[model samples]
Target: MHMGKSYQVSAKVDEGMLASALGSGDVGVLATPVMLSLMEQAACACVQDCLKEGETTVGAQIDLAHISAVPAGMEITATAEIIKIEGKKVLFKIFCEDREGIVGKGTHLRLIVNRDKFQQRAAAKVK
Candidate 1:
């Protein structure tokens, strides 16, 4: 994928996405894990159209910070931009926000892999 390519996705905070429900913390605000997942989703969408057949990306690393608490029912957006690509590794700059302002920001890494080969590797672990 080309550098500077980006994608954005939006979601409404729900009870199931709360920190308390996700077991990330005791508070009822949006969970950090959920925000990270959304960021990953945006990153995936950013490069999906550019992938070759049978190729998919898997998250390899994330360095993110949750800066504010978002209560349930609020809408939030996650945006991911492709900042760098090195061989099969892709780096992204990610940010999340609500109507108020930015609530999270950081970087993420994903590795492009053959879907069947990756699944075979994963399946081998159970054997």
Candidate 2:
């Protein structure tokens, strides 16, 4: 796969469910999943971008830093860029910016493999 490719992704949060006093939530913990979803999307898109050139590494892991908070109703966007390559493994630098500000930033690691087989192996590992 070719290097230096980038991908963009976005998501909006529902403010009503993010309030601290609401029966189901706490603000800090609530937005974490939103940031994670963006990261996952960005990482996946980056992998797809790489595949356009040729079959390349896929996401194996992610290291994320949630530095800012996003209230409900705000949208978050993530951009992932390929930074390095090691054989079948790829390294990406991910940044997430939202209506509030930079909500999260991270480094993601990916490795390539047959998709269907990967899922089967992953399921077996859980058991």
Candidate 3:
């Protein structure tokens, strides 16, 4: 993947994305896990066009801080920019924002893998 390239994904906060609905908290704001998923979705989009057939990236790690609460009906955008690439390990600077301002920021790491192989390995765990 090329360093500095970025991608964004946006979604409106809904009842299902709320902390109360997701069981992450008792409040009605956005859930941290959902925000992280958005970040990961943006990260995946960043390098999707560059991957070869059967190759895909998986989230390896994340360090995030949710600084603001976003209520349902608000739109939030998550951006992921490639900061570093070491072999198949890609590091991204991630951010989440609403119309008010930044709601979260962090770093995320993704590892490139063969999709079929990864799926097979995961399925084998149940056998």
Q: By the lDDT metric, which is better: model 1 or model 2? A: 1
The C-alpha lDDT values of all candidates are: 0.97, 0.71, 0.97
Ranking, lDDT, top scorer first? 3, 1, 2
lDDT of 1 by residue, 1-127 (tens): 7999999999999999999998999999999999999999999999999999999999999999999999999999999999999999999999999999999999999999999999999999997
Error of 1 at 125 (Å): 0.9
Per-model TM-score, in order, reads 0.97, 0.75, 0.97
| lDDT tens per residue, model 2, 1-127 | 4577888987676654353635444653335655666776777777774463334445578888878766666776889888888877788888889766777888888887766666787799877
Candidate with better TM-score, 1 vs 2? 1
Q: Write the per-residue lDDT of candidate 3 for residues 11-114, one digit (tens) a residue.
A: 99999999999999999999999999999999999999999999999989999999999999999999999999999999999999999999999999999999
Instruction: Give the count of colliding residue pairs in each prediction.
Output: 0, 4, 0
Task: Give the TM-score ranking, best first.
Answer: 1, 3, 2
